[model samples]
Target: MTGDTMRGAARAVLVGPWSARTWQACAHLLAGFPLGLLTCFTVVLLGGVTTGLLVTFAPALVTLAALLWCVRGYTALQRDRFATLLGVVIDPPAHCREEPGRVRRLLAEAAEPGTWRQFCYHLLAGPLGVVGFVVTTVLWTVSTMCALVSCYAWALPADSAFGRHLHTPSMVIELTVGGLLVFHLAPFVTVGLAAADTWLARTLLGPTDIDRLRSQLVSVTQSRNAVLAAADAERSRIERDLHDGTQQRLTALAINLGIARQTLPDLSGPAREVIEQAHEETKQVIAELRGFVRGLHPAVLSDRGLDAALSGVVARSPVRVRLSVDVSERPSPTVESVAYFVVSEALTNISKHAEVGAAEVTVARNGATLRLVIADAGRGGADEGGGTGLRGLTHRVASVGGSFRCDSPVGGGTTIEVELPCES
Candidate 1:
């Protein structure tokens, strides 16, 4: 439709008949003749037999399934044919293979619109192929003969009807001009036919709009999961680096400072004051670093599992937490991590704004769900909108196909509940 494209196409049309693309189109049409005819036979013959056999219970179902699968396979070959001959690739529709039972899978596949679309395409191909093959072949044969009449005309008997029809120089000139015109026009015709076939192939063979959207959704979900997993892994790695490298070095510095203070007893008063201050600051810094690294990702969680990990968390909380973990089996690492963060964040919130000194935390696994409940009898009206840090916990829970709820009424205690997929 663009001016530049129109001009380019006009140019191609004027001098494009001898190009390889034109010949490829011709060959494609010729090859499709046989392929399309075979498909037509498959639809008419196999389909009719399957329909008649429908009254018979088991045999009919089996035959129908086989027919559908054969049609699918045959459609794949047609797709490859066009791809190979005309350099056009048409992808097949997406088919879910998740059904566990054989008969159920067959029923599901049969119910899919993709199967019927392909069958319809098979019905139309034979007629389309016949037209393309006949038209292209006729143009090629007749045009070539007319263009070369001057060379082959001498071989015709002068007295024969065919020779007499084109014996004149004017006729030869006219026929040759017509032949040249037809030769130039043949590419457009073949291209037009091939374009029709391309449209049909894509419409029937390619995934439907719903299927395409579903595939996109699946891809986005997978990408989100990957990003979440990568982030968790990176956090764990940083935690390890801080614990093994930076924390160890800081601890050594604190120990050295402590040793320096006690080992030399003959230092000046000003010097001793500076050393004591430095030693105190170093110890404080070391304590903060240990908490920071533990908060990043706990090593004990990975070693002793969720129950012991939650116990450690409770031991460190400023607000006393009555902890109960009923999970007989540990959930996945991602789910466990989410559960830990949820409880930790809730407890931190209670410590900061709850005006209460005690809370109850429960972690339990019921079937495929890992559930966590954190309850406090503090002054209420607590929610994510109040900047209680529950929003991040909600997102974290959802990232693993889990749920989070905050139930905090005015004058009623806050109860935070979370559920995570154990498999995830």
Candidate 2:
């Protein structure tokens, strides 16, 4: 073997004998014993009382509710202990929303499956704890006594039970060897027991699989909403900066150029022609900037609401658009913005891909939902997975708890529909 390989082996042997994890596992096992026994006694007592009171229906219901509540608290304490000692953290299930009355809320909590799972865990923990505690205590005690046998060997009389067979040299060798083996093996045994306890706690005390999935779904939904909200805020900020800062300065420059063009001498030559061209170019730039600002987020959308904003969209479409709005009250700005983009993109696609001259755009509010439908009398074969713009619009609608759908048959008309919740 190489010199490096020998040194590495020596280091491994030294490190293996002094791992902190071994002590932690031993401590965890020791703590579980008392906790498990206490939990077991409490669960049994409460369960028995609750069952016995079942003869009186109302009392039984009340007692059972209280017992379940205690079990939840106990499980939470155990979960914390497991995290502190073993570094295993399990997520608890979401609490049920409270109903109107106190009794209803209590009953709701009692009906949860997690509450019963906790009870089951407490029921089984007592025996497991006893077994772990006994095995760990016996192993450590025997190992320590054997390791120190040399110190006490001379004190015992020759006729005594242990002294009769004790040959100091041979006894020391045997006891020392046994002690070394047990000392090294104890950590593995304790760790195994700790792993078992952790498994039981996670299986019964932690959230169920369905609950975990539901939690993940809720988290995803919230994150999506946050992203959409941030994007919308950023768009609004950019639009404001352009309109209030850049657009204003551009408008002032165009006005100044026009004034300079008219005030310059009527030379009727190259110099006069240059001034007029500069003025016209400035005017053209101002118009393009206006269009860009509108595309970012139209001021009309904020000032006049979806009705007028969508009217602007229809007016700008290359093809003629039949438009209608039936909203009794204005929806939120976010809903209106998404609706406008949906229409704008749809019309853009229609003018580019659809071989028709005109399309219909409809917007309506029914109860708490805002509905938008854009239909075109053109040859249609729109596919969401075919890398069409409709797929992006679908995601946009879904980001705000909305649904998007498209129906288009080859050589037939295409229809795109979206429904957004506009609850105030």
Candidate 3:
């Protein structure tokens, strides 16, 4: 009511025992003992009953499953409590898979390591909870009582111990000092116990180190795949722009030039020669643009599929290319793009460096893997470190978690084999 008292109260609320965290710590300690006791009793009774009934296999299985699930439910409750009170979030392990049959589902739940971890949590919580509760309750109660005892001692019955012991001011002051020490110490004690509880809960209820690492790895893999998909999509867009926009314009320009050279035969000799030179350059530019667009990403690869696309690639190759594609199901677009590039680059290398007149290309799918084998019976001194595109192919294959192997002996024929995942 007084200004000083109000100011003291405000200070305490701001940074003392009256703060929310202190109260939460107190609440956590207060509840831990009962929860621990109940957990211990439940585990003991359930384990005992389940063990005794093990002779009956069916009954034992059901009981064991029930026990694991019961512990799991308790663990969930503890997780909720920690999150609500101290803002600590724990990630539970994701190890259980539901089965069609009830029995199988129960088996999966029981067999999971997380189930046993929850059970162990209950085991440890028992003793820790009881001790925490006892310490917290005794310190808070006794300290407050002693610190305020002087105000109440006179009201006690005359023959009572407090009334008979003189209850002097000196004794009152001494007890008040000692009690105040404990009163202040109580919050620290509660905080320490709460910290211990948090550690136990997080360790038992949350994911293991391996699980966290696996989660991070999965997240990174997903992000990397997303980037690859985006890049592939962008390449397709660029290819489309070239094929639809720039390539179309260039084609029209070349045609117009060709028409002018053919139709304008009455032009002067110098003008006719200029028209002829421009027509030839226009044709050459269109051809180069076509090659550039195809190198970026081919429309056939997206419109049809890898099979149709590879066939077109082999058909265009100057060196005799024997192409065999056996893809039953279409792979993902990103994967198809990578495959197209791999085949196209390999063929280009063969024509440029292999000094071969013939090359063999075979593509097949085995389960979820796409296999490609390109071989040439020419001089076979292919080096990935060499200026050939083998190094680039290796990196591209690895980007999609695929493997690229090149086997080329100096005198033997060159063989390039690649295996890519069919993410579809």
Candidate 4:
């Protein structure tokens, strides 16, 4: 007990400067209180009046201005302060805007969920700021008086706004003692305030970071599921194509060849040779079916990986292709397959519609991302709805949480880039 007591006393004596810092920081935090108060009050009152006036004129103009100032402009300031004082990353408000046109844009802005959220934040800021002001100011004043009392023999006088006098000796002693007592408890109160600030900032400003990330993950998962569905749908389509066209032709050819084979014994050598020729034609039709099915889904993509699968695509491409791959690590089967299909489809588009001489394809893995860049020196002007192939490719990429961009200008070449996360 004696040793512990001595250690604590030494620590307390050493805590003098640190205690000063703590009080100083608290004071600085309090000093900024008035600014927050003014900002909150001004924004709320102005926002309310603007919203009311919006009903008379264009409601979106004034409300949008208020939102921009309150959230987009001031959010950074508030978030930075929260991080410094409370050590938290608060989400900022989502600022949504529409293309310029008076009535259309105004209606669009007013209809958005984010605008309403900004208005709510504006309304709440005033009351929240007032409470924060009182707590911070009171705690800071008390801590300062207690620290001043450590050296000064007399207590300081309290000046009132209403011309009240409060400088008696007994009053000084009581207030000084009270200040010292409250100062000791200031840290706990400050910690509570910081936590409240973090919570409220996150709730009012925008969605939490974790929440945003989770929502993104959900979207990715949904899109990937869509891709899988689309793949199955595509396989069924290819199967139907074969069944309806090549399969029927081959069946008729088989019946003819069988009948010729049975009559070969009674026929002349020339007749036998003709049946043999027809059999050869039937074999060609079967070969074409195999090739077409392979084009739809190559087994090599599963066996040899994306590099070899893409090589096959290049060989079949009508346009000259320059392929470069620097994938050091193998991605998950699904991801690699999706990426290969994306590149293949893009190259196919270039061959069919780009009207270009040559195309370049580069696939690489930089960290956990799989990057595919395909650029063609062909006629540009590629748009999302330009064709069914590009449209399907967009949905496929989106399904895997990947982004697809095609920059094809008139009289210029087309360039397509896709980035997919390789998490597995």
TM-score of each: 0.77, 0.72, 0.82, 0.45
lDDT of 3 by residue, 1-424 (tens): 9999999865653364566788898888777788888888888789889999989989898788778877877888788878887888888765676788988888788778877788888888789888888998898999998778777877745454655453567766887888777787677778888998898887888888987898898788889899999999999899889889998998998899889999987999999999899889988988999888888889888889988888888888989999999999898888888999999999999999999899999999999999999999989999988899899999999998999999999979899999999982
Model 2 clash pairs are none
Q: How many backbone clashes does every candidate have?
A: 0, 0, 0, 2
CA deviation > 4 Å runs, candidate 3:
1-20, 37-72, 95-109, 152-177
Candidate 4: list runs displaced more than 4 Å.
1-32, 59-69, 94-106, 147-150, 154-178, 208-214, 217-424
Which lDDT tens digits does candidate 1 get at residues 137-242?
A: 9998898888888887767555556555566788778879899888888888998898888888889878888888989988987787788778889989999998
Question: Any idea how many clashes model 2 has?
Answer: 0
Each prediction's whole-model lDDT (CA): 0.86, 0.83, 0.86, 0.70
Q: List candidate 1 segments past 4 Å from native.
A: 1-13, 47-65, 101-111, 142-183, 249-283, 322-331, 360-377, 380-387, 394-424
Better of 1 and 2 by lDDT: 1
lDDT of each residue in 82-119, candidate 4, tens digit only: 66654566665544455687656656666766656555
Model 2 compared with the native: what TM-score?
0.72
Q: Candidate 1 — worst ten consecutive residues by lDDT sum?
A: 156-165
At residue 200, candidate 3 shows an lDDT of: 81
Number of the candidate with higher lDDT, 2 or 3: 3
Give candidate 2's error at residue 94 in angstroms.
5.3
